[model samples]
Target: MMATAVVLDPAVTMRTPEWLFLSTGIRAVDHAVEDICSVTGNVFSEGASMQALRLLSRGLLGAKARPEDPAPRLDCLTGAWMSMVGSQSGVEKGASHGIGHALGGTAGMPHGYTSCVMLPVVLRYNQPVNAAQQAMVSEALGQPGTPAADLVAGLVAELGLPGRLRDCGVKREQLDMIAEAAMHDRWIPTNPRPLDLAGVRALLEEAW
Candidate 1:
């Protein structure tokens, strides 16, 4: 019998990337985590998000940026919830992640690369949720007044990332499974709106 081997890299290997992320400020990380949690029903809150960002920024941005003033404990919980909402919106709007995930394994791409590619599409898909948020997103991207989806689409294009799952090597037969997996994921619960398998399938199909 042949045995498969598992290997783990030392913790030090992660130090650099972690530091880099911290350097970028915790608010960014909070955004990433919250986006993941929001759509997926993951545990997160905006206040907690602020706390983590504060702690991380203290090191990266400076001690002055640290969260010296503490928020109420419940604020952390609310932040956590907000984080989930943010994460869900990220995934739901573009459907680009599905492509990125498929491409990651097939093309040896990194997680950030995929996310950069897909964020716009997800924002576009969820445009109906709220125009204010969409407008804010556009402003953040430096393309104010642009529709959120279009703004993101432009960003994705500028990044030179693949826009389709088929281009990334996903098969038609796999769509059903991927859609099912996404809908049932823990993050699904945190999504601003409930998503069904069919909705997930449609997103996948659109991406393809």
Candidate 2:
């Protein structure tokens, strides 16, 4: 969604409230994943990304606690829109999205489920390069001082979403192919740290 928005209008800039209300559901999930691994130096974009995650966490939790309430639903939608606010036309997504595309395109995994399983592992793998950002992510998700990966995994579990690649029917044998494909994904170049086949494979192994 952010990718499409960037392509359609590179000059686009979301308003503050607009961003807070825009990110939700799977779109919020995508934003959170992308921000964690992004190398872009834009502070506003990074801050918005973290806020999107925080909003998403609140929205999801509210929705879970009161399924009949419409407020949480609206919050989620707003969060989704905000999540994509700073995405630029030429900027690529990071490893979670890149790997997710490979998994979805090659392995036929559902997009949301792909994120559910891969995001935590991607965060953990990229932590060395982006520990501060990851810490922000953890705080946004309401888990200060905890490993971002575990906090993310906990969120997935709380949402009753798949938390492991194997749980989503991803076979161990397919990791190599997925890793190879991820290495070539456009998003790989924009990852916070360099990504090689070996590193990609290691991330995949952890996801598996």
Which is the leading candidate under TM-score?
2
For candidate 1, lDDT tens digit of each residue in 1-208?
2226433222322334532232222233325433432343223433343344333323332322332323322232233233334344333422444444544554554554444434554555566654555564454345678775674444344434455666656677877766665654554444454557787676667767
Tens digits of per-residue lDDT for model 2, 1-208: 3343322221232232322222225446666557644776467667677777887788777766765566766667666666775564233568888898899888888777777777777777788888887877777777889998887777777777777789889999999998888877888777777888898898888888
Candidate 1: lDDT over CA atoms?
0.44
Candidate 1: where are CA atoms >4 Å away? 1-110, 113-118
Cα lDDT, model 1, residue 93: 27
How well does each candidate superpose onto the true structure, as a TM-score? 0.51, 0.82
Clashing residue pairs in all predictions, respectively, total: 30, 13
The most accurate candidate by lDDT is: 2
lDDT of each: 0.44, 0.71
| Model 1 lDDT-worst window of ten | 69-78
